[model samples]
Target: MPKILKILQEDHRHHDILLSILENQVKDAHLTGEPDYDIVSAIVDYFLTYPAEFHHAREDKIYEKIVARDASAAEEIGHLDEEHEACEAFIKAFAAALSNVLGAGIITRSQFANAALEFIESQRRHIRMEESIFFPTALRVLTTEDWASLDAELSDTADPIFGSQKEGQFEALRQEIMDWQSTREPANDHVPGDHKLRL
Candidate 1:
């Protein structure tokens, strides 16, 4: 596998961890009739920090390169790009809703719970499309030279949003989220009318 693909696969593992956290929070919220603020905040932080900055940066750069090389891929790449934009927008909205709940204390716990659930659903679908369709297509279509160029580009492209030294910060943030998840009790509680915990 190319270095970029390897990074992306590793990222998928992290995304799985995050999805688990989100599912757990949703389950706990429904069963306990309490919002898991820590998990919620952690998700928001991850979206704002890692996903938005690092992962998306890599995806955008690689996809842009692919499109540049193969004009026939323009349509597919465009659709994928739009999906990326949609995911970013949803994350921002979800994060804003979370902030409103925390800062203004206006939204009910139930409302916050719904928001989290919706965010989770959106993420699940987005992940499926990327992992199943977009990534596989890229892997099949991109040549060894293309992959090499992407790797080189990724190394050179500094994430301004994450500062110049982003890799270290990204790893640190990932560890922080993992440590938090490890310390928390498994969310097995069931809320009325809500499905069983899937985490």
Candidate 2:
């Protein structure tokens, strides 16, 4: 596989881990009467800000090229642009519903669960679509020259939650990811180094 597709799959794994944390919190909130609003807020903020705003935008840029190079591939995926928008919307709604906990129009835990579940399902589906279909196709079809152009266009949108430079706000999420990562085998477990085009 070309390095970019590998990097994308690694990104998907990170996203999956984060989503699992969010789901666990949602389950706890459902069982207990108290929700970890802070953790939930951090997660929602991270998703809306980083993955939705930055990652999806980067993918859309590559997707543009994918469509240009292979029209049939584009036809299969349809409008992933819309899927990105939908994820952000779902997260916003989830956050709003969580925020409702502190007010008169409090959403029940079940309602919050539904919203959270929807977001998780959507994200997993999107990732699976990319991993199973898009990544393989792009690796097979997208040229090194194509990746070079995309890499040139790619901005330095380093992840705030999982990047080298750890920012202040995402500390909890970072810890959660790190703690989860630690449990897994440490052999060759590095997040894919950012790809610098060599060809």
The top-ranked prediction according to TM-score is 2
Instruction: Give each prediction's root-mean-square deviation over alpha carbons.
Output: 7.3, 5.2
lDDT string for model 1 (1-199, tens) is 8888767665655565566667676787778876567656766776776777778778887777677767677456456667778878877878887898779658877777677777777777777667766687788778898888878777544432223445543454455455656675555222112222122
What is candidate 1's TM-score against the reference?
A: 0.74
- Which pairs of residues collide in candidate 2? none
Instruction: Identify the leading candidate in terms of lDDT.
Output: 2
For each candidate in turn, the TM-score is 0.74, 0.84
* Each model's total of backbone clashes: 0, 0
- For candidate 2, the 10 contiguous residues with the lowest summed lDDT are 190-199
Q: Each candidate: what lDDT?
A: 0.66, 0.72
Q: After best superposition, candidate 1 residue 88: deviation in angstroms?
A: 1.3
lDDT of candidate 2 over 116-171, digit per residue (tens): 89988888888877777766667666888998887677566677766676579887
